[model samples]
Target: MMRIVTAGYSRHTRSYYSNQAHGLKYFLVRLQTEGFCQALVNGTLYTIRPGDLLLCKPGDSYELMVQLGSNEPPSGDYFLSVELNEWMLEWWEDYKQEVKLNVGVDEMLISIWRHLVYEKRRVKDSNPDIMDYLCRSILLHMNRLISGGVSSNPYERSVSNQIKMFIEKNATEPITLRDVSTAVGLSVSRASQLFKEAFNQSVMDYAIEVRLSIAKERILIGGSTLQEVSFLCGFANYTHFNRSFRLRYGMSPSEYRRQVRPQ
Candidate 1:
């Protein structure tokens, strides 16, 4: 399961830094809105300017040395930070090692960051609802930034991910590829293509796999009849469930349950 931790925005600046560094305990991401910050990332000096973003991992040593412009105020720089979940940390580590952000800054993401920070500032004392919305917006923006040139692939993966989440949430209800596709704004054919590309199976095939797995678990518990387990796992009727069970397991659901469960 994935989880999201603390998320917020802040704008601050420092000047003429003495040589100092903190033992990084969280992923540090800074979107520079104005001015610049000289950072020592992995012992390399990177001069980050406006519209630039810096990505840092936990325990990575870095120091910030901001250079204020002559026209810029004494404290003109701004940044935002969010502590990452463990899964997020693992994803970042993989990204840093593989994906190169060596290209010039992306203006679109910077604009998104600016809008998010402004939105965050607007409802400081009240509006928890708006804050929650802003967090989701930020997440989507970051995902777009990281997705790179794979236009249709991300859409495919997103659809599949949404379907899996929905299936897990509504395991006891009947579901179909058409249902999942409509839920994520795609046609059944497109959803099937995407799901096959990502998961190596058709949507209905995957759904049946999930259903049968759930049915097997229920049967082993010995509380429900085979028909009842089939219904609970979202099969339409007893014969259909029995046919699927025989095709997959080479035996009826009852026989499999009897073989697995102690007398």
Candidate 2:
């Protein structure tokens, strides 16, 4: 179980500074969702921007400064102060938490945080279990976003990664090239070109690969028939799914499942 001490949104129009030189008392997770600011992270002051995530453990020196120049947008962020239990501690130790990570402002991740914030605001009526699960979901999703590889060109890398993440999250649903493009605010041709340049595979191909991977897992897990697996994994029909699976694995879905499963 995890306990959230405080969770809310903050926006600074002028200038603001939060200094905790003596260190913090609880785990702090902050996501910069709009504009930009500066923060002392790992003994160095860093310019934090939208899509930047800040993770701080207890007793870590944390400082945030928001300096707004004339005609500049205000700094905005979502923050949560958490008290970790045993399970949360285990999850924390499993990953090397950096002072700051550029995990891109993923909508799904923000949605989870928003829900957690709303539940926390419920005060006396807040359900502990719901808050706990929502917090865990945010952390887990952040982990995945942070694990993605970054390229040399920051702008290109961010756009390419946004496309990849969108495909991954929606692969099980009916997605198209236009859908991918719209999600990342890029034209269809541009999105396709960028994805191929970054990943060496076309967007549609990667989507098919993701779909087949899901289909394979469903086949191995049983309970779902081949046709059902195909449909559930976003395949238009069993024939198309069979063809794609065989092309990727060199065996029919049923054959692969049989060989991998017990006799």
Candidate 3:
């Protein structure tokens, strides 16, 4: 059985989540109950809605946004953290690494989440064995859903997915398009062309997107200085970071930080 780290519900209004894998240690499972959200996993984007759930292995950077305009309403969801074991780790390697997997709409799963959260809130007052069993149940069910929905040629698709995952995992490093090309065992043109066909974006552009997403998340969570955030996110300097940030997001990093910070 897996260890239940933490479980809670998140309610957001006109909000967004930008997260990096820099020092993450636990595997994560999140369930969406309401509103619309989009998640970028390994350079590929997924549009998430009610009844959607996602699983992220350790060291995978992901960005989630609730496409809420000024008049849009709030969204709610539940998320849980758990310790990974050898069995699950082995399972991940075999399955297609699709982070945003769907389990359809199931109220039974929601009930399990509620029960887990209630137990988490109870602390030592709760039974560890029961919590562990519930947590294992969720993981097993999600893994089953993902495994059961496999594509016909996962071995081939996994190559493209591996390329995207490599970029996301190493986005903070000073890696080049050539490095990505070589890592994928494709020629420069082939790698670039294949990536474009799959993601509809150039490899370099996706790398920049990954870096910027991680930078935003770091600023919000770590509260690191602008220069530090830029450097940590693989920008050559703050000026380039500022320019890219403004171009990609229409707001400077500092301004966005202030917007998301508590008032």
Candidate 4:
């Protein structure tokens, strides 16, 4: 089981300082969504900007400062602290989690973080199961963002990243290959080949992956039926969504919901 101790968005207009000299008690993940701030990460002070991520483990020294300069914008970030269970411990050890990373400001990533914050605000009504899954989703998504740039050529990497960003933002719409290629100023064949080489998957295949991920989040949040979720997530119909969901998750959406939700 996963446990998220705290999750929220913070916006600081005035200066703010948080010094944790005694070390952190839980895993801390913070993403600078807007403005800028300085943080002492791993004994080095760094200027954190939009799209910068900070990952800190327990017993790590962490400090954050927001000192606004003349006409400087206020600092804002989405932050969460997690109490690692056995599974999370394993996942953490599997990757060499860096203190800071330049993961771009991805809309889908922000959406997931927003959902986690909203669910946390539910307090007594909040479902721990939902929080658990959302936190896991966020960590996994961050990992993917960190490792997605597989190309060594700087131009190829930039183009591939642009294609991914386009797909992420438009996956909920009825987007096509041509749209993706056009967004990145590449032809269909060139964009397709670039994305496949960079991510080891076809463009349409990656689109389905994004769709199913959105559907899963909606399904877990409830209120909407399976068919509605399918359409809302850009699936052609329930049948296709159901088949894809099963193929990826090994169970139908309903079964997944039942298993993960509180009875």
Identify the runs in model 3 with alpha carbons over 4 angstroms from their true place.
21-23, 90-96, 143-263
Ranking, TM-score, top scorer first:
2, 4, 1, 3
Which residue pairs clash within candidate 1? none
Off by over 4 Å in 1: 1-55, 58-152
Instruction: Tell me which residue pairs clash in candidate 4.
Output: none
| Model 3 weakest lDDT span, ten residues long | 148-157
lDDT of 2 at 249: 88
Ranked by lDDT, the better of candidates 1 and 4 is 4
Per-residue alpha-carbon lDDT of candidate 4 for residues 1-263, written as tens digits (9 for 90 to 100): 78888999999998999999679999888999889998886688888988888878888888999998778888999999989678778767755456777776777788999999999999579999999899989989877776786876545765787788888888989999999999888899999999999999999899999999999899888999888999999999999999999999999988998987868
What is the TM-score (0 to 1) of candidate 3? Answer: 0.50
> Would you estimate the TM-scores of all the predictions?
0.52, 0.79, 0.50, 0.66
By summed lDDT, which 10 consecutive residues of candidate 4 come out lowest?
Answer: 90-99
Can you list the residue pairs that collide in candidate 2?
none
In the range 1-263, model 2's lDDT, one tens digit per residue, is: 88999988999999999999688988888999999999895587888989888878888888899989899998889998988578667767855456777877777788999999999999589999999999999889887766554455545667888898888899989898999999989899988887788788899899999999988788778998888999999888889999999999899998998887867
lDDT of each: 0.63, 0.85, 0.75, 0.87
Tens-digit per-residue lDDT, 158-226, candidate 1? 455666555655666887777887876888888677667766766777777788888999998888888
The order of the candidates by lDDT, greatest first, is 4, 2, 3, 1
Winner by lDDT: 4
lDDT value for model 2:
0.85
The number of clashing residue pairs in each candidate reads 0, 0, 0, 0
Residue range 59-142, candidate 3, lDDT tens digits: 666777776788876788889877778756765675445676555544446677788889888955888888887876776765
Q: Which model, 2 or 3, shows the larger TM-score?
A: 2
Q: Candidate 2 versus the native: TM-score?
A: 0.79
